[model samples]
Target: MSERIPVFKPYIGVDTAKAAVDALDLGWLGMGSYVRDFEARLGSVLGVEGERVVAVNTGTSALHLAMLSLGIGPGDEVITPSFNNIGDFQAIRQAGAEPVFCDIDEETLGIDVEKAEALISPRTKALIGMDYAGIPCRLDALQEMAARHQLKVIHDAAHALGSRLHGRSMAAYGDITIFSFDPVKIITSIDGGALVVETATQVEALHRYRLLGMDQSARRMYTNERAWTYDVADRGFRYHLANLHASIGLSQLELLSAFIETRRDACRRYAALLAGVEGLRLPATDFTDVAPFIYYVRIAGGRRDDVIRSLSEAGIDTGIHWIPGHNFTLLKTCRRGDLSVTERVGREILTMPLHSFMPAST
Candidate 1:
């Protein structure tokens, strides 16, 4: 049998394994020097200050913390695209806020700023715009609309860590930007996430919220030491990233530029190979300015399932980026704008195998 190709794979190396083992041997285990080092290096990569970044246990936790730190809660409504990941919706609910689904732009697959603005009302406290497959949303437009309504903007850059918009890093634009380093993401920490905020107040709030609302000094913890006494002034969750995960992340971070280049090359190759196929809509972009997380194509005439089956038989795995949030039982009644584009795209989209350092045969 021919080897099966996975739809997603991490680009881990021997160095990455060694880094994790070395961290384990340090015996400090939990959030420590390695985590701090990772955050600093990540911030440097994003061109943000060290003080503006916070590392957490998962991408979901990053979203939850972003919502909480922004003071979004019961009676508040957050506008988000119905085409987004379920994690974005759950994060709003986790903060006791309602999610108002909006449609997506057919081109970028990101939020439609105009449609999202139409969903805003007196109760709207924030807007969550997610980058689709590393394609950035109209963040400038979203920010402008949010500014008019005095609403906060949370950028879900989970798929866009290495992506740049008009030559500026994705992290350089949004009010609060979050990134994921899960096992299958562009980079893996085993599993981890980060948030980049603007102000010192927001930074301090995120630190507190990710550590059980304790007023413990992060500076002290970064050195692998903890203060004996601390105060709890608000509710928080156990979301801090550990040294082991951070160690792996640090190792991955060192090769992020190369990983991005490799993925982009694979995506370009896919585009070249699959171009001109009738009834298929290839990704709109040329894979420049974006660090693609997945290479997906839209199959027309209801042949998506058949294509998946045929690919499976050939030892090639495939995936679906998501099922529309509104289709889920829990989100059925959520207020939403017209989701015509989102619904159609959801049904037709099929993720193809693409990995960093992907073999030419694949």
Candidate 2:
């Protein structure tokens, strides 16, 4: 059998291993200096104030915290694209809010702003816009609509950490942005995420929320110290990112630029190679402005499953980025607008193997 090609792989190496070992050797593993360092470095990369960035255990935690910080609760509703990951929907539910499903634009595979606007009602409190496959959503429009309607916006940038919009980092534009550093993401901390907000007050709330509502100062924690005299005032979770994972994240952060460049090159190659193939629709962008996560193609004529089987038999793995939130039984009864584009795209989208520093032969 030929060597199997994975749909996603972390670019781990000796340096990453050494970083983990060194972090272990430090004897301070939980939410310590390394986590602080990771958040600082990530903030610098995103051109945001370090204090505004809060590290969490996973992308979903970041979403949940963002929802909590924004005061979304049982009576509130958050508009989100149904053609999105389950994490986003669960996060909304975790905050005791209902997720109002919206449609996506066929071009960007992002929320259709017009459709989303129509879904807004008196109960609507927020909107969650995610970047599909590292392609940015219509952020400016989303922000404008949110402001006009007096609603908060959460930018689910799980797949777009290094992606840019109009030459600015996606983090720079959104009201509140969350990034995933999962094993299969553009960068990995094994399993971690970060939230970037606009104010120190918001940061303080996230800090308390991520660390079990403790009023302990993060400054002391960064030096690997803890205060037993802290107070807990509100609901919180054990969502803090540990030093072990943050150490890996810091190492991975050092190579993000290179990883993004190589991934973009691979995506360009895929687009070029797959062009003119029958019964397929490729991504619309040229990938210059995007970080290029998983390169996907829409297989027509109900042949997506057949193509997946063929690829698996050839020792090449493929993936379905998502199954669409509305199709799930839990979300089936959620309020929604026209999901025509989402339902069609959900059935057709197929992600190909993509990784950093991919060899030419791959």
Candidate 3:
């Protein structure tokens, strides 16, 4: 059989395994010192204050808490792109807010700020922008638009951990910025994510919110202690990241620079190899400030299905980045504007194999 090229394979090494073993030896596997350590390291990487980064169990939890922290709730509306993962939509709905889907820019494939601005209303509380395929949405323009309308901006930086815009890190924008460390992401903490709050007060609230509303629970966790008697100030959830997962995240952080270079190189290689292939539309290869998470191409001439089948037969795996949220039964009833670009992209987008661990021979 020919060597299989899967959609993605995480870069795992001896250092990652050793870090997990170290956490195992520590015996306190809950949200302990290691989680704090990971958060501090991540803060350094993003150039944010260490205490401002709140580590969570998943990126969805981060988004959910972010909306709630910003006081978005029932009867409020948040604008987002339909060319995004369903998690953002679910997070808005979970916070009792409506998600107003917008279209994407044909070139960058990121949210269309002009379309989002048109959809805003008195009830629009915030705007959520995703870094699609590691290319950041025009955050400055979006933030300016939000400011003019007195709305908050939340950045779903799930695909943009190591990406940069105008020499600043992706986390430097938005009222709140979030990251994902799922297995297929640029880095993995086994399964973990984080939210970056701008103010100390908000950070404190996020710390408590992630630990089931127990006030100052993060301080206790850092010292390997728990509060036997605690008071719930407001609503919260058990969403804090565990030490075991954070340990793995720390290991991944150590290799982030190399991982980014490898992925960027692979993406460039794919662009070079697949350029001018019939019916394939490739993204621009200007990755000077971006760390791409996926290598995607647009299949024109209604040949996406045939291309996928051919690749499968050759032991190569592929995928679609997303299906528009409006297509989902659960979210079909939500408010939305014109999704022409979103629908078009959904039909043509195809994700090919790209990862840091691929064989150099390829």
Candidate 4:
């Protein structure tokens, strides 16, 4: 009999279901002890203090709140890679800032600092970077670039939960770091994200930002007290992560190291098995310290469509990581320059089936 494979699957088991039920039975389903515990464990993983991490319900919300707390507004720009999910650009536009699409290094497919330097204008307030598939972004170069420009670094680490660079977790490399726990990602809290803000001022701002600009008053209400006082320092959103979601996160965190190793082993095995496959160029990965989020390969000579058709016919589901933000309709009216690499790579990238599902073959 022939075996089937899945594109993306998480390792949520019986324990996860039990934990969720228990949390819900407690009747405190909002951001409470479970959320706090998850944040604490997550902070420990990032090598940060417990107070540094603020858990939210989605990665986009994390980015939106981070931008609000970072004080990014209209007329400001945040430099990011042109080849990325539209959501990144959407978050920038949502924050009332312009996302300056920068070119990426072809080999690692990460944001290129040199191109970012050229795009830097007086209004460039922050640098947002993504790992592109659990591979750490060129942090040393990116940090230097942000330092020279005096701009803050906010990492969109949706695909880099278990990744590190130069022996340091990716979270430590940015002034602000955001991670996603969506079902398809490295781990899932069903759907969650977190913002890491180390400073007191940023934390205070973030508190208000996530709870709809009602920082202190909201906290008092939760404690059954009437603090009929509030101020909207700035426009914010309802971005808090629920306690039930955090319970699932806590259960998953207990198994992240093992989860990372499983992904690494799968990636290595896939590389070994397909190394001899002709006409396919595997993604360039940083094996030193990174998790394998998704295994992508390039199909050369215009065979991408053909290869995909063949795979789909065999019941295999696949996907493209992104469509190159520079090519989007939103940027069509803007004066966008040549992002030749992004335009070229967008057509060739294809993520394969390598999640934590498919049973081992004999």
The local lDDT score (0 to 100) that residue 272 gets in candidate 3 is 82
Counting clashing residue pairs in each candidate, in order, gives 0, 0, 0, 0
Query: lDDT: which candidate is best?
Result: 2
Q: Give candidate 1's whole-model lDDT.
A: 0.92
The C-alpha lDDT values of all candidates are: 0.92, 0.92, 0.90, 0.81
TM-score of 3: 0.98
TM-score of each: 0.99, 0.99, 0.98, 0.93
For candidate 1, the 10 contiguous residues with the lowest summed lDDT are: 331-340
RMSD (CA, Å), each prediction: 0.8, 0.9, 1.0, 2.3
Local accuracy of candidate 2 as per-residue lDDT tens digits, 103-176: 99999999999899999999999988899999999999999988999988899999998888978998876678
Summarize candidate 1's per-residue lDDT along 161-209 as a digit string, tens digits.
Answer: 8999989999987689999999999999999999999999988888889
- Sort the predicted structures by lDDT, highest score first: 2, 1, 3, 4
Candidate 2, 19: how far from true, in Å? 0.6
Alpha-carbon RMSD, candidate 3: 1.0
